[model samples]
Target chain A: MRIWDPSIETLDRVSLRQLQLTRLRETIDRAYHHVPCYRSKFDELGLGPGDFRNLEDLRRFPFTTKEDLRLNYPYGMFAVPMKEVVRIHSSSGTTGKPTVVGYTKKDLESWAQLVSRFMTAAGVTDEDIVHIAFGYGLFTGAFGLHYGAERIGASVIPMSSGNTDKQIMIMQDYRSSALVCTPSYALTIADRMEKTGIDPATLALKVGLFGAEPWSEEMRRELETRLGIVATDNYGLSEIMGPGVAGDCLERCGMHIAEDHFIAEIIDPETLESLPFGEWGELVLTTISKEALPMIRYRTRDITRLHPEPCRCGRTHVRMEKTRGRSDDMLIIKGVNVFPTQVEEILFQAEGCEPHYQLIVDRQDNVDSLTVEVEVNDQIFFDEMKLQRIFIQQLEKKLATGLGVGVRVKLVEPSSIPRFEGKATRVIDRRSR
Target chain B: MKVEQISIFIENKSGRLAEVSRVLGEAKVNIRALSLADTSDFGILRLIVDRTDEARKVLQAHNFTVNKTEVVAVEVPDRPAGLAEILQILDDVQINVEYMYAFVERCSGNAVIIFRFDNVDEAIAALLGRGVNVLKGEQVYEL
Candidate 1:
């Protein structure tokens, strides 16, 4: 397989470490000088950019958390001024308040390059037609893959999410070869195709790039077999740079991080102590080449280990395992990241709904289905059958649109859900892990 | 006039039907006519009950989703082509029947058919205009 940017992707260990150190120092100095959040953090740890003698010094610095971004709100953590920042993206905030991120013109250019490297490594080329199904708007998944696919000179069908039947028709008529979407959504499409009697093998799809939610090896096999494509996984978060952060090569090993732009570290979640290579722990990332919002040892709550050994595909960067689970209470159903608290918040927003709700996630026919059993108020108990059915449909639409995931809402009777005295058990994930 | 039918939402599990019966039996609410429509996950238990409000209240108290639906009871000839004659009237008037089930007992040698219609009032008017026997809520609950 051909490697993209071999000089950077397969750099020698000694030279790669030196480049990482230089970029790290530059990021620290930028964050400390311009962003007060990072300055205060560095001061709180009694450290400075000059204090970094080597890569190991990243441990002495205080870790930045998602709470910090929320506290900073919009643009408070940006290293550059708003005038210089040409693009902006914010989290979906399926919970409550969203975290905003900005990128300068240079940042966007660099982001596209990083993303292009991954698409190339996964065997996508100018001849391939990439169909991006990730939803557009404030979410970064679509735009990230869009720019990268364009950068590689590939024909892009920017068919952003939903419209399942139309998507299949375009995929067939346009003869698109690459599919970029969430793993769960890929399975959903495959299942829909089978139900419609559309032979997936007759399609021109050759490669699949899936991410944004945790998936299993079993799911990868299912997608590959049903979609007739070579499935690959990529990793990224909007708080950092999105989709280009890391991706798998043709070898189908772990995803290779773009070491030149970001530093990857794993730490034991309980003690916050850094763990050695090949050990399972929480993945921590630091943006070493960001121009707008350079993160300094940002804590990504995803739990996984890293393999630093050289990949068979000839890439020298560290590879992180597919995120198995989260140290926190985050549920990824049908490729949408959700928190149970978000479900409760939506439930409370709708009238005639009780505070009690149970989220049931089950995987059937290689796709994930989320069913929210919401307790209805006593007042709704006396509603006419027609009105009750309308109410249930309205609640279903509200939750699905709010969370950006198709949710099945069941109007259970009041007090049917068991009350909890302590930390409430809000989610019953039956997806078989 | 239309009859009040109690529809209970039930999970598809063993002993669930018996549990609904036990709850109603304890509450002394007699089920006059009943039918169940189910898929793999859940079932809808439709019943013509002697006491609509009481059955719904006791079922709700026992943590069952209960709703009162309006359905009409039509007495058809207890012979060949009886059900076909009723369907032909609905087809002629363009009145859609959502679902239908047979009552347990017969009235004057005629079979009682319970029907849920898209517009209960329109179906009742169309049935009565065609000289069809449209039973009232009180008579169907007793039968």
Candidate 2:
């Protein structure tokens, strides 16, 4: 169990770029000769190892997407033999097909080191007990953190998502020191804690590493205040390792990218061209240390910006603001593009509706109509006429203010809607003509 | 002794019921007796139709959350003491009725009452053994 402090993490901007260039050269050379997928792609573009002498030439490679991973399917993109692969993780595949990721023994160690580095950055020590609440089995969130916690020499709880009551019980009984899960689940835990008459502030949790879904600053403020713990954001995709790519320090300003193991790029999602510092665009990543499967310029589809300025915490790695939104996850209601997070923010702020909501989109007379079914708590009694009217009016006003479009809000009873244990299915698009 | 009943879970919203009706109507399926068991958020629309399979297909094609169950329909004379006789038999058997609805039998001087009981078979046997007329699936479909 070892930890890298913020002051001694690794590589300044100059040395970091140099290290990437060296790794890029070796990686390209290996891929060109070994992997048939990369060999044909490189040959088609008339590119060679010499062409990738620096970061600029790395652009000569084509960008990989989630669609590409799916197109290749099971083992099409493996750069190494099957015997060399040791572990596999996959995306949730809620949108379409699941993207499969494989790793070798060495790859696992590298992933563990990077994740341990992230935990250490968030102040996790060997004496801490980490309660990992992310879903395990095929999903990278759980196992990625599991190995990392073991590497950091922390006692792992492996709570593996859902059963909020059991999670809280273990947190109280075991005196857990840290929590790892999606931010939504963390809020749910806090909500359940209140209902169970337990104060979250009295829990043994000192820090939380929340990610795997796009969350807003308002959500962070709510979670931190409710849970009374230092909540930090961890960013990763199964396409490029797992939950160890970058993490936030105590500064809470932005997540620090592990530039030593991976290269981070921001490009205009539509134009596919690079954006300057502080400019919002799509995030692209290239894994230099991954062996079983290495991706070059993979479009992450997450909307965020890169801050090149060094943080006051003394970590020299580049910092990125928490993801604002995902380009693909945006739902077009009528003519306006609406984000689920925007609706969530309004629901949290509104005095009417509970946090549970579902967006129903259907086509009527060749025009799309968005209906938001909001679950109201005990505050709105169905038998009370006055309360019902007030609830509807409050919800409609709040939704219009938050989304900038007129929305129809249907008040429903609490717990009447379906609850998701993993990624929430918020939007249902039924527009078949 | 046996009756086919279709129950569909529907989220309470404008035009949802209309949409379900439209699907069934387009399929030329006639609904005999229908009742909605509702809460504030969602409702279960229970129906006895002329063509249960066709009605279910239509509803499912329209993406309605529909399910099928077995119920009992008893035939009673359209006169005083007709329903009382049926209730006396059910009470003797200690069979509780969760919900019940009525439909007049076409061209017959009798009313067909659909009963969703805690125990459908026991209720059917009790009414039949007591010499009470119980409608079969074909009889209910014909009605």
TM-score of the second chain, each candidate in turn, equals 0.98, 0.92
Give the proportion of true interface contacts each model preserves, from 0 to 1: 0.26, 0.03
Best by TM-score: 1
The lDDT leader among the candidates is 1
TM-score of chain B of 2: 0.92
| Alpha carbon deviation, residue A33, candidate 1 (Å) | 3.0
lDDT of 2 by residue, A140-171 (tens): 88998999989989999988877889999999
State the lDDT of candidate 1 residue by residue for A294-354, as single tens digits: 9988888899889999888889999999998887777877666777877788878876345
lDDT of 2 by residue, B56-107 (tens): 8887666555567788888887789988988989999899877777874542
Residue pairs that clash (backbone atoms under 3 angstroms), model 1: none
Can you give the lDDT of residue A280 in candidate 1? 96
Lowest summed lDDT over 10 consecutive residues: which window, candidate 1 chain A?
A377-386
DockQ each candidate and list the results. 0.17, 0.06
- Model 1's i-RMS, to one decimal, reads 4.4
lDDT scores of the candidates, listed in order: 0.87, 0.79
